[model samples]
Target: MTLFGGLAGVAGAAAAVRGTSSRRISPYDLLLMTAGTHKLARLMSKDAITSPLRMPFTRYRETGGPGEVMEDVRSEGSLRHAIGELVSCPFCLAVWAATAFSIGFLFAPRFTRVAASALTAIAGADYLQLLYAQLQQSAEGTS
Candidate 1:
């Protein structure tokens, strides 16, 4: 809870310091950010490629999904365990990812949009790939 509070405090401070105002975000940008946040959170938390970053705090368990992996949080210490849990849970990481992109949008909207668009595209591609694989499997089974 302290960590979450700290994040909220930092975001609030940044908004005050930067004079950020209440501008309504467009639906397109909102969707892009949502998809981008989902992909970014999953990539950071479960993607096999990013395991090295989480290795210190988590132990590799098994393959999770297509390119994702399951990991157990290390119970070495409070901070480390907390970090491990945060990095291992996509639901938890989503908060951080959304916060980061929100901050990025505040600081540099253009760059944030580009990055978010790329992540959103990747997320779309991932779904398509899964659908394709499922169709192929069905076709093979029916043959």
Candidate 2:
């Protein structure tokens, strides 16, 4: 959950930065991105997660005149894939919608206003992106 929350924060920051650089993103774009991200996440699973070999660990040692010493450490663990099977799952979408609603309602006037505004912007951006994609497709078809 924390991981997802952190990612959401990054997404929010990205949206803010993008808005400053150019026209505010449309809600459509936000929807598309969210969909895409959810899809990608679903494709990932726990079994897919893996840890890097040659565990890099720093060790401190007492040195008479030098700085410090390092020791080698080895551990065995299973790879945990962050992406779950939520991409194709409708449950993921339901959870997202529910979570958003919960947050909006719980936060109400305090944070809801900002959250709603952000969501609207995202939805607009998403719509624009979708429209652009469709336009591109149509153009290609005519050619």
Candidate 3:
């Protein structure tokens, strides 16, 4: 519980500081930040290079299509547990990512926009790719 409490305390402190200088986040912008954070977490947690960090805490199974694999986190109350909890769950990290991005927008709008735009574009591409694959499979079945 100390780990979680510590994280919360840090987050609260960051928020308190941010509140002093940050403007109110609009709903529309919040939506964008949500999407970007979702993509960022997915990429960060599951990518080939990064998965190794969280894989120890998860079950490894081949994705069945290629050399890809999936990680299913095994949760426990162990205080020394891995960062899989934070990295594996987009919901867990979204607020932090959004806050950082919001601050980025405040101080470095150009870089933040470029990075967020890239993440958003990659997210769209991911959806389109998945849709295309499903369509192809359906067509193959019909043929």
Candidate 4:
């Protein structure tokens, strides 16, 4: 498990560096990758930071005015809506499910935790790269 974790960390760091430097990731792709990484991290660390990453669609909700009121009324409803959408969205759900499954498999005594950890790390790296590219493009366009 330790070896796997190390490999994952290294891979994730490498991918993040490359992605940030290359500037090739799209917004949607970045979101998916971030979501996956967060999920993976949460599974491995049993931490709270992954909460925000798990539900990307919720971030789109309006925060004020009638929209806010509507959001408030429908907050639970929105969660359900988001879950349904997440389950249906191939790209988003794939990573979400993969991370969950990997975590589960890793905990089984006989399963290979290191490989799972490494896989999550690779996913995280890809996501970081995507995020980097998106940020780079946005920065360039604004400049």
**Tens-digit lDDT track of model 1 for 56-133:** 999999999999999999999999999999999999999988888887777778898999999999999999999999
Per candidate, the number of residue pairs that clash is 0, 24, 0, 0
Candidate 2 ranges with C-alpha deviation above 4 Å: 1-90
Task: Give the alpha carbon lDDT tens digit for every residue of 1-143 in model 2.
Answer: 67668856765566466553233334654454455433332222111221121122212222211111222222222222222223223355446653453333333433644554455565466568779989999999999
Once superposed on the true structure, which residue ranges of model 1 sit more than 4 Å away at CA?
Answer: 1-4
lDDT of each: 0.91, 0.41, 0.67, 0.46
Sorted by lDDT (best first), the order is: 1, 3, 4, 2
- Residue 116: error of model 3 in Å? 0.5
Encode model 4's per-residue lDDT on 14-64: one tens digit a residue.
656655323344454345445555545434222233334434333333333
TM-score of each: 0.92, 0.33, 0.67, 0.28
Quote model 3's TM-score: 0.67
lDDT of 1 at 140: 100
Residues 25-50 of candidate 3 have per-residue lDDT tens digits of: 56756666667887887776566556
Please rank every candidate by TM-score, starting with the best.
Answer: 1, 3, 2, 4
Error of 4 at 1 (Å): 32
**Worst 10 contiguous positions by lDDT, candidate 4:** 65-74
